[model samples]
Target chain A: MNRYLRQLKEGILDQNPTLVQLLGMCPTLATTTSLENAFGMGMAATAVLICSNVFISLLRKFIPRQVRIAAYIVIVSGFVTAVELLMRAYLYPLYQALGLFIPLIVVNCIILARAEAFASKNKVLPSAMDGLSMGLGFTFALCILGTVRELLGSGSLLGYRVLPESYPDMVVFLLPPGAFLTLGFVIAAVQKLRGMSEERRRRRSAAPADTAAGATAPVAADGAHSAGEADGAGRKED
Target chain B: MNPNQPQPASMPELLTVSPSPHARRGVTTSRLMIDVLIALAPAAVWGVAAFGPRAALVLLLSVASALLAEFLAEKLLRRPVTLRDGSAAVTGLLLGMNLSADVPLYIPVVGAVFAIAVVKQLFGGIGRNVMNPALAARVFLMLAWTGGMTRFSAPFAYLSSGVDAVASATPLASLKGGMLPDASLADLFLGRCAGCIGEVSVLLLLAGGVYLLVRRVISWQIPVSFLGTVALLTFVFPQGGADRLSFMAASLCSGGLVLGAVFMATDYVTSPVTGAGRLIYGCGCGLLVVFIRYFGGYPEGVSFAILIMNALVWYLDMLTRPRVYGKTRGRRGDRKGGGQA
Candidate 1:
């Protein structure tokens, strides 16, 4: 149970495939122009991820070590094709909107990376959870970017007129440059919050021993992270 | 960082002392900024005088918003506030100058905020940004609000606000359609033209440029090469006219060419440091202006040209890198053996 919870934490924030590990940037940048498109891309990529993770985990023993990468791609592409056809048959407009991207999910780094790193060595349940968590993280990132771009670019939200009529539209946000700009800022904010939390965690863990040495002001920042971890362990004894 | 050092015996003895050059110089970042502000005063005065209080209001709003944004950003980023350096003020003033006087009051405020917060501060604050903040903000305003950004009013519109304040075509617009504007050479030179607030007066802008030169605030390479190239190109190919000289003069005097070349292109942080690189960057700006003016949809290309050249500044520096004296490690076996042979 603890292992499953740890995997969830890792996938969501600590080792997020989109924000931290920086995988699957193609779909993240291309389909995130609107909330609807981003949601569709996210669900499609999640479907592929979950199916690939389960199948790869089940066939782990049969797959030869030497041919693992090729085997993984074949398995991922099979699932991607399934999702693509299902979308084309049922959700035609979304399929047309995300036409090339659905098939291209086969090459998404997150799915292949998880398969190689976690699913091949783990059981089916935990592997599925990993896929779910990573998919959720990617979806959250895409939605944040999409909401910002849509609101600023067209003064609307999810195809609804939220802003007043006089609100001047910033047309640049609809262009390619706006995508990069919005993504860059949102990612920067995420990283900043992460850094602050890590700093707070370090300070809290180092509290008991801090009285003996009046202040352990970091003389150099190079080894500060590791030193903070060491201090956390030291406080465990007290 | 050295906390174990001996404490000062008295409260007044805590100051650290260093050796040599004890006399403090009068120059500082703030002083240089004040000099630039002083140099820009004449052209700004003329712009306000010619375009009326709307131009003045734009300038004031731009400077105020820029200062406010700078203060907030520095505080948020946990960096020391340096708004007293007046870089933000300069950026806002230049941005206002680039705008058409007829734009809504909120345009300058938005441009100023973007200039200070995004272009200047987000890229690591003053002296660290890759492009001129004011020019980048102007380009953003131009791209996002095309109608408001390009609506030029006739000269002395402030005097007769009802009639002349209506939208009028700029000289650069007529030049785009292959003819000169109705304004004559003397009117263009003396600021009786339809254009951006501060860019109409070629005479006063040149005077400001000369003031900066006299004060040693800027070197001459960028302005000289930039203007010289535009002059050469237009003189060689007179569009729709047998008189090449008049066309060349009109090209030089019209639109934002003089304003951009003198003030925006020579921004210290955005332009290259070396002499050779500065010349090449200037020539590149001039060529791009000519190219865009001739072929692009817009009549004026000063902002775009400067921005496009701004991106190449790092490469320009690398290509024009001055060889250091003691860097003799790379002339290896092939060159020495081939020379001997």
Candidate 2:
């Protein structure tokens, strides 16, 4: 149980597919123009990822090493086809909205990467957990981007009017160039946040050592270390 | 005498030392721009003659506003002002040519601001802009002030008689709105119609285009392929064909095709760089122009088509990349020598 939880944490937070690994950008940019579309795409990709990961893990022994890639793709496409048909029957509106993107799941690098790197070697249960976590992380990132774009682009979110009537819609936010600009800024923000946390970790690690060393040196060493840590934190924050 | 004077520094020593290819010919940016300006004079004169002095007024206003906006934006951004590059002037002239003389003077002012300040400078200016500044400004103004842009009443001062200047639709607009009047091929070619100031005279625009070609300021691939595609498509599927000649002439002369295929679509900043890429870009622009004209809401689609092709220029360049000097063409996997073993 502890091992599975660790695996899940690694997939979602420590190594998020979208934010950390930066995989599967085509669907991320294309279908994330709206929150509803993002949700539909995220759920569809998650379902396919989870099913393919589990099945590929289970059949790892039977698949030939030479043809494993081809085999994995065949397995992924089967699951994707099943999800595509289910969406068509049950969620017709979302099905129409997503259109060709649903089939494009077959080409999504994240799914194939997970299958080749993790699922092919891991146990079925752990593989399934990894799939679930990574899919959820991707979904979260998509939702954040979609919410921003839809709100700014059309002054609405999930069909609800959030912005005031006086606000002029920035129509360009929904255009193709907007996708590149927003994604670039988002990546830069994530990098900045990571840098901040790394600095905090360094300071926290140094604080106890400084206090321990202060007993020997009295007061000067303590002041020096504290100032050093503060300066490091300041640089990171800037 | 110089050789005797100093034992005399040999000819090589007397000459200023520089890197290999020490010989150079003069082709400065300013000189290139001056050439373009000279080449554009015939068309400008033709436009003034066709539309009266208002054409000249619009052109001057657009140029002045573009320069002012570029200067102000650069001053605010603390970047060196680049008006001397002559790109802003070119953008201003193109913007003026795209607009009708009767358009409110403030419209061109707004367009100049959008063209220079927003589209060009904000995107890192001149060569760095991804799309054509003039076309982007035209599209921006068209969307922001659609009514003001679409109303093409004759210039008030240009009225020869005491005739009430009618708000006549351009030929493209007329075709799209299903209200095309009986117009001859001669009128379309000779600038006897209501259209954007410079777009009326196909003959004069062609003269400028030919001069541009002769000067090698632009390559022929883009214009030839673009115009050829539109002509072929229209010949095959013209809606109103009284005869082949009328159909071909109408398709060729009507709308902003002359302006677009000759000047706008051929814009250096927005177009592809390679020979094959330009051909593909031109064909794509042509197809989109015809598609939008026949099926879409807009009467004319030259601006939209050029903008769309501008967005695709990167992809087209990628597709048509010239092969490396000594590399052999091979399939993706095969390039790794997978089948050789």
Return the TM-score for candidate 2, rounded to 2 decimals.
0.61
Chain B TM-scores across candidates: 0.89, 0.87
lDDT of 2 by residue, B1-341 (tens): 12222364455656676788766667656666666666666766777776777678988899899999999988875578888978788888889888887777777887898799767775666676778888988887776556667776542335667654577767777566543434577887877777887787888888888988888888999999999989888778766534555565687898789888988888888899999999999999999998998898888899999999999998998777776545554455346544422
> In candidate 1, which residue ranges exceed 4 Å CA deviation?
A61-71, A208-210, A217-238, B1-26, B236-244, B325-341
Each model's interface RMSD (Å)? 12.9, 16.2
Q: Which window of ten consecutive residues has the lowest lDDT sum in model 2 chain B? A: B1-10
The alpha-carbon lDDT assigned to residue A215 of candidate 1 equals 58
Worst 10 residues of 2 chain A by lDDT: A229-238
* DockQ of each model vs. true complex: 0.26, 0.03
Local distance difference test, each candidate? 0.84, 0.79
Top-scoring candidate (lDDT)? 1
How does model 2 fare in lDDT? Answer: 0.79
Model 1, range B1-341, lDDT digits (tens) per residue? Answer: 34654567758756779898789777777777887788778878888888888899989999999999999989976679999899999988899888888998889999999898888887778898878999989988887778778887887777974575767888899889889878999988988888898899999899889988888788999999999999999999788863899889989999999999999999989999899999999999999999999989888899999989999999998777665454432335425544322
